[model samples]
Target: MGESVLLTSTPPEHKESVIVSSAPQSRPWDVHRLPSAEGRNFLVTGGNAGIGYFTAEQLAATGALVVIGSRNPAKADAALASIRSRVPGARVRHLHLDLADLSTLKSAVDGLALDLGRLDAVVHNAGGALDDPPRRETEDGHELMFGTNHLGHYALTRWLAPLLSAAPAGRVVTVGSFAARSERLDLDDLQSTRDYRPKRTYGRSKLAQMCFGFELDRRLRAAGSTVLSAVAHPGGALDSLTPPRPPVGAPTPGERLRGLPAALMVQGKDAGAWPVVRAVLDSDVQGGQLWGPRVFGLRGQPRREPVPAHMADPAVAARLWAASAELTGTTDPHLGFR
Candidate 1:
């Protein structure tokens, strides 16, 4: 959805204003060049489909033990089979997780405890906006989009922070969005009880996620912890890029029409997952920095993007963090300043 603007060349005056600078010499990260992830463990939320599935598959192919947190057993089994076929002997398992239901999400860690030796990375990518569904609240009573996208991941990361800290280089890579660039954080009405719109609410949720991700990194650094937190966005990638569904019913004639906008301006899921993968494994990437498609925020390569002015505000971040903790009833003692 953020592909409306395209930057072909950089002018001297606009250099600082641009979120992504075109690096003349540096090449974008190619998945083929990835180092082995052997002995590392990664948990990917929403691993059943779309960008999350591709990210998990890429990790599994690189010899990482991937724990995919998904809500549906059927979709999880299908994704597992796809991974196995593509990456022979791929070590991967699935855990049931419903982002709308906090209790179900909490079970993800406990369910995988026996198999999880050390948490190397956690990829929070499980969130979607319903298409014109009735106004809904999560099981936790928060707005559906905000609760599922922000609060759920907030709790999950806090619960697993200790495990992440124990690893040599742990990371929490949250999948944010390019849509967020158009929205502002509305901390006063987080649940949207006063005024609500689906697309805008989705964008607000993404903004909250970005703020939390950067703020978490700041707190971790202050606490002298090695665990790093960063945010990544899949610019303009759409569901139409995924593999076609098996013909079970009448063919939907206008399906491609709905995706035409994204098709023209976006890359496939394979390329969309690059930023998240880079954030998870790239040693050069540090905490608090954001990664996104370098080519006009639509498609090309992952680049360290500049944080938005609002998101960079420490006061806003602190307020959001405090509110999130209060909403989710989660607190990380390790993050406390000594």
Candidate 2:
């Protein structure tokens, strides 16, 4: 999180150069008009607030049974309350799901399978900045950023794959970030044992998440798995979902000044939810396709393409696939064996 220290003191002209130029637009006219899950089940991580909150609320308003997965069940209920307060009778239930801890992932997945009877989609959206120094690592010893942001979801997806594949036209949607350009994969130090810089580590983790989505698509096709895999990025929408995570220490004057412009351009989490919605629900969207915003990289209507650089480097992606399977220990014993 303090990787800002790695950057030179020289201030960049803009905090976020990618700016949305066009007004928000939906897809090719009802092209993604999914059945709204009327009898289907959907699992959304970090569903207590912000984009997750709004998207789940919107889906529940449409009659879907949304299983809200969050680390904090209390906060999840509050998020559900906020939605119900708005829609009068939203259908969102709460379950504890801490993405940083893989152990919790299995229990939550099992509970969902038993409680919901079926799961149509699993929205892998729980993530945030590790504001503290980069010293902390997961109990599993993976670097904190890569572990929580990427590996946790990776393992969760692996654990839930069976249910996802069983669902009719199951979709596993993973969230990506615009900052992935900073992702420089250092396979030698995948766990940050040799190096650790917060922003770089975060970007690497996001890139790994994107890579996982694409590679999973290939693997699914190879296995003839019916699940569809797609990736989406919120781009850079900072709404109530972005809790006021104050710095460990007071910020320098330059830091405050550098962040002022971004404070203005950032839209609400609701505005950021569209691209992900398109990715998860769009019928025309193909596997391995990355959906983002058309304007400013991501602030307007969702599109069917990815910004350059993010989709580059297939080699790193393949390495990431092998590393993730090795690290998580969740891969099927029958498949993925050389």
Candidate 3:
């Protein structure tokens, strides 16, 4: 239930940047044209609100059975109710999950396995831009942001890979960030134990996610698994930019000031969810492709875009894959010796 901190501080120049409307606009592939998902199932992390909630709501509105993962059951319940209120007959459920704590994943996965008869996609959308002090570690002993944003999802994906493979058109969609484009990778110290700055660490984690998403696609294809993998970024989408709904909690003053850049530079979450929904539902999109907004590197319709230079390195990706496996204890044996 903890919110992600803003990835960047507001620049003085952003004060003069133009403010735009938050309404959803026409796009090539948009929520309005989303295909029916009546028989399909999906799981979205951090789905209680923001982009994740909208993603789940859009899918469930079109008849997909959605399972939202959140650490707070009350918030999840509120989200589910909100969905049903907006889209009558939406088939939605919530499961408690804390991405910063790995010990809780087993029970979550077990519960999901029982609930899901078939899964069409899993969206790794749970992550924060919160800037905790340097070297803060999760219950699992990894740096908090990296562990929650990348490692926990890594473990969750590995655990759920089989069920996804069984579905006729399974996909794994991991959310990246525009920060990946401007940031450099520190493969040697991915945990950021050596030195930790919030934005840099967040960018590194997103870069790692981009690498993992593409590499997993290659591995799945090489192993002949039916599931597909794709990555997407939300550009500058922020909760503040989205049209206000029922209030959950008030934003801190820092959060308010930080969101000013977004008010000028970013699109709202409704449009931001496009690329993610596209990655999950677009039959034409290929595995390993990246999607994001079309303009200002901040907002617009979804389009295929290049992966970050660091993320595109095959050797780096392989190393990251092995390291993730070691970190999550998901070796080939754990993956059915694939």
Candidate 4:
């Protein structure tokens, strides 16, 4: 997965040769000294808890107008309040969003457009994982994990395309997962109707998401859109290692002590937010690249890694795009690439 290669064929509209630069930076990306994001606007889905919460907090500290999208109003308020407490004068708000219901997406996007007017980047960070179940489905009749994790973001991206394109350098950062690394997609049965294991099904959903991000890059490049799509994953981020954020996450003293030994292998959710933060703020990051932690693909600082073979397949990506468009009813001819 550490090898780098272009994942799509050139668009017929453009005959010019495209040269993709290497992901290595001349100087290490310093997470502490992030460039200012003043005047820019960002949206983080599922920003009320876990890695998304930390991602919102870190971005808010950069002076960006960050909006936290969540289904729970109380938790959203709590997350915003927590960020303001940590970073005085932080500007953050909440947008009602339920990825499980596709019908509501139009209104959600409308509200976002009315409030923000313009958006610079969107972090598809919110995701659902079912550890055990008789198998569940969304309001849209799709598998809960696949629908919420992939199709939800797929439709959201389509709705946000205009706002993203209007920005000087719009960006779409898909927060994928390390779990996706070991999984392969079953395109014929994406919802796992035939074979459903909680963990495996969850992994397949994420794998679909990563493929969408890469495929998006190809389409964006072909359409000559300025919006860039990049994929990133937070390595092994654990709750016990995560620093306490009142009302959001507050690990007990015993929990912290128990997690001490695991620190060697995993990291806090705050640290897990690094690769995502980098993908959003790092000026050098290019489209269609995969980024992850530096150590054992588990924990450490963020670095660019080669896209996994399964996640990088152009054929698989294209097919998934078609399936997603059909499932989500986002069949506008110019929805994504425009």
Superior by TM-score: candidate 1 or candidate 2: 1
The reply for model 1, stretches above 4 Å from the true place, is 1-28, 243-264, 333-338
Which scores greater on lDDT, model 2 or model 4? Answer: 4
Clashes of 2: 1
Candidates ranked by TM-score, best first? 4, 3, 1, 2
- Winning model by lDDT: 4
Off by over 4 Å in 3: 1-28, 132-134, 248-264, 333-338
**Per-residue lDDT of model 4, residues 1-338, tens digit only:** 12232312435432211212334445667665566677889999999999899888878766788999999999999999988766645789999999999999889998889877889999999999999988999999999999999999999998898789878999999999999989999889999999899999999998999999998988899899998999999999999998888899899999999999999999999889989988988889999998889898889989999888889899998889999999999776446556
Cα displacement (Å) at residue 248, model 2: 22
Per-model lDDT: 0.78, 0.67, 0.77, 0.86
lDDT (10s digit) by residue, model 3, range 1-338: 11221212324433311121122334345445565556788999999988898777767665678899999999998888876655546789998999888878877887888877568899999987656674678887998888999999988887787678779978899999888888777878989988889989998898888888888888888887778889998898876666444543335667767777767668778678878988887778889999988887678878889776677888988888889888887767235313
The per-prediction CA RMSD against the true structure, in angstroms, equals 9.2, 10.5, 8.3, 10.5
Ten contiguous residues minimizing lDDT sum, candidate 4: 13-22
Q: List the residue pairs that clash in candidate 2.
A: 19-296
- C-alpha displacement of 82 in model 3, angstroms? 1.4
Which 10 residues in a row give candidate 1 its minimum summed lDDT? Answer: 16-25
- lDDT (tens digit, per residue) of candidate 2 on 1-338: 11111112213542111111112235352312323435667888888766676556555644567888888867887777765544434567888888778777888888877876657888887776665564677868778878987899888887687778778788888888888856667778877777777777778788778877777777777777778788888767754323221221234556556655775555446557677766766567678888876676656667777535545456767777778878887656313211
Per-model TM values vs. the true structure: 0.85, 0.80, 0.85, 0.91
**Candidate 1 Cα deviation (angstroms), residue 206:** 1.0
Screening candidate 1 with a backbone cut-off below 3 angstroms (N, C-alpha, C), the clashing residue pairs are none
Off by over 4 Å in 4: 1-27
